[model samples]
Target: MGNCIQKTNRVVLGFDHSSGNVSQKFSRGQKKDNNYEKGNLAEWQKQKGFGNVKKTMNPPQTPSVSGCLENSHPKSHPLPTPNPISNTCHRGHKKQPSFLPLPKPEAPPSKHEESSSIGTLQPAEPSLSLYSSSFSCILPMPMSESEILSSPYLKAFSLDELRKATANFCENSLLGEGGFGCVYKGWLDVETLTAARPGSGMPVAIKKLIHSGFQGHNEWLSEVNYLGRLRHQNLVKLFGYCLDGEDRILVYEFMPGGSLEKHLFKRNSPSLSWARRIKVAVGAARGLCFLHESKSPVIYRDFKTSNILLDTEFNAKLSDFGLAKAGPTTEAQTHVTTRVMGTEGYCDPRYLTTGKLSVKCDVYSFGVVLLELLTGRRAIDETKCEEEKNLVNWVRLHVLDNGKVFRIMDTKLEGQYCKKSAYVAANIALRCVNHEQKYRPPMTYILEILENLPSNKNLNIY
Candidate 1:
């Protein structure tokens, strides 16, 4: 790699340096810090907790955990529960699935009973309506996976099939604990969804939901609706899902390379090359671009490094569509108004202010992910100094304003990365996290810039 890398190096040489437009030069992907002064937070902050802007400094800690939504860490590589993933995929031949949504739903009351307790039941229907908040009422009728998923690519998996394939959920078959439960590695005949000889069958990851909740129910629906239907190289492949009785399971293609978060944050693992990081970013951006550009746009609500899984070759694939929703449409220019939900640091402030759900929210979250990729850190770690816990705030205050991109770049990269390329990448990330949603760059443009980074590899090297 050379001393400088620029896609169409839009890095403007002689501006005020602090001006917002400086970032627009490099592939026009720069987003600025959110002082939140420009936006009208009067109504938003007027609400109970939103009012006190002063007290807003990391109140109660948004918790670095993704709850049922966080997918990586232990199960990504199957190195047991608490071990850092081995650097090489072949090192231990271990793999697991931590990327599924929702456990089984609580059973509804039987027909002849007087409805007591906090339970509601509705008509069991075959016509699937995905937007239900409480699935207990609108129980899913027994339908084959192929029947439920309109797409020819997806199949319906049965509990028996999943159980047998996973060797009856044997401990040795366990991969890792995901959002709602444990993920197990299994071998099966894809055609039959039946247990096959260990090495003879297709290798797959099965997510077994342990607990259940209303939000988890909705996320599970979201997973089935989106992952089951959409197809893209950067998006993880969903072979099928299981909804038998109280057992809710998801089946996915095995990702031997594990999660991007582990590769970046886990100790003792090899660091990803600068080129590979760029490739991963480009792949993820392409996935987002595909979603946004799809016939029906999707908002990947949870755009974090942990959700980006990799194959043996280190090709990144976007996982956990449990948080994804359809993007705002032309008719809904303002935003798709809804309850505020997302990881704290990565959430777009504008969305919280307006209760609006727009594609821009995803852009803001992706910007945070870019920041994480640039600096190997968690979005929120209680152990970190109060200010540093929130990666966005830290980057904006330190790197973006200071223009010390070199200081912020992950030291784990050692001296392998190109400084100029690093600077440009930081600019791209800054523009992405800009407080104003409009200022954030679109994934399409972002993808174009990232895709061209490889050409600049020979330009900048430490």
Candidate 2:
């Protein structure tokens, strides 16, 4: 009986081990076998502070061993399957895809699985530029031909040419000396480069001034300032100037006939014909009118025949602007006052007495010159007898008593003067010499009467 009981217990233990509930299942077989396993589990649970309980594994099913083995790669990643139906066709297919999507990629290895994979990847390095790090690869700028040529200021003449033309400023080439400096006659090459400074077609008179710095510079500038800027038939023309270094020279057209004084009073030359004399007087009057009544009035402080220059054509130009004074503008209330310095006989007595010079002073001097032209006599002559010594006093005596006045006419003229025009001109002279400044007519009035003088050259007295 004892053997049979032991055998039954073994059978019960086997069944429990084979099949059991998760809550009450035992690894050993039968109820007795279950009690033995539970007793061992209870002892371990009591030590761990928990009741005994059975646990079961619930895992997702994987592919069959054969399918997984065929698809498995030596790299531990499954090989991608190629489907002919899904692959894009070769060229010349009727069913061309409008848009194609990228093929799905294989999954990356699990972190634990990839730990022993290929060599470790280095951190990505920063990108470097082929050109400069700070600057961009922009193109260089281009320049125009005109821009390059026009960049520099041009010179009128080359330094070498100027040096040669001035004869290296030789002392003998000197024309006239003045407060500014000496004037030199120079031969300038007409085909020079100063904004069309070509050959002057003839030698020019170059007035050069020594350096005195910029002190009183504007006044120095004013000396040739108007001459350089003015343009008229009777006015002198300034070609150019040199303001470089210690040289301040003004270039002008050379007038060949010399001045009116050279021809008028010089003993070696015969007196000008009445026709030429009248032409010169009219031309000079027109020049004075231009100065006195232009946009800017100019008073030629010295208006005697000496200052009247004659060109080759015998065209008269009023030169010697050194003593000229500009007229008053609207903003200024008074005309300029300057120290008295003028030829004695030609100076206006009213201005000499009052030291108040005006445009009328020039008109008074013009009248005196007219008298000189009429009588062919000097304003103040020392060769005559004491009674006739002073031309003004003698003229005053004769003009008051006209009977013997014709005797005082220049012997060279041989009575070649219009009697009626001479009387009118003498009356004009008498009016110009009036003691009262207001009694004298303006130069413009004298100019108007002289313009109307009979042009018939044959009406003469002998």
Whole-model alpha-carbon lDDT for candidate 1: 0.61
Give the TM-scores of the predictions, in the order they appear.
Answer: 0.67, 0.56
True lDDT of residue 113, candidate 2: 30
**C-alpha RMSD for every candidate:** 20.9, 58.0
Candidate 2 runs further than 4 Å off? 1-163, 166-184, 189-200, 208-220, 243-248, 330-335, 382-390, 403-405
Tens-place lDDT digits, model 2, residues 305-382: 766777876877776555566666553644455545456567676665445667777877787777777667776667
Model 2 scores what on Cα lDDT?
Answer: 0.51
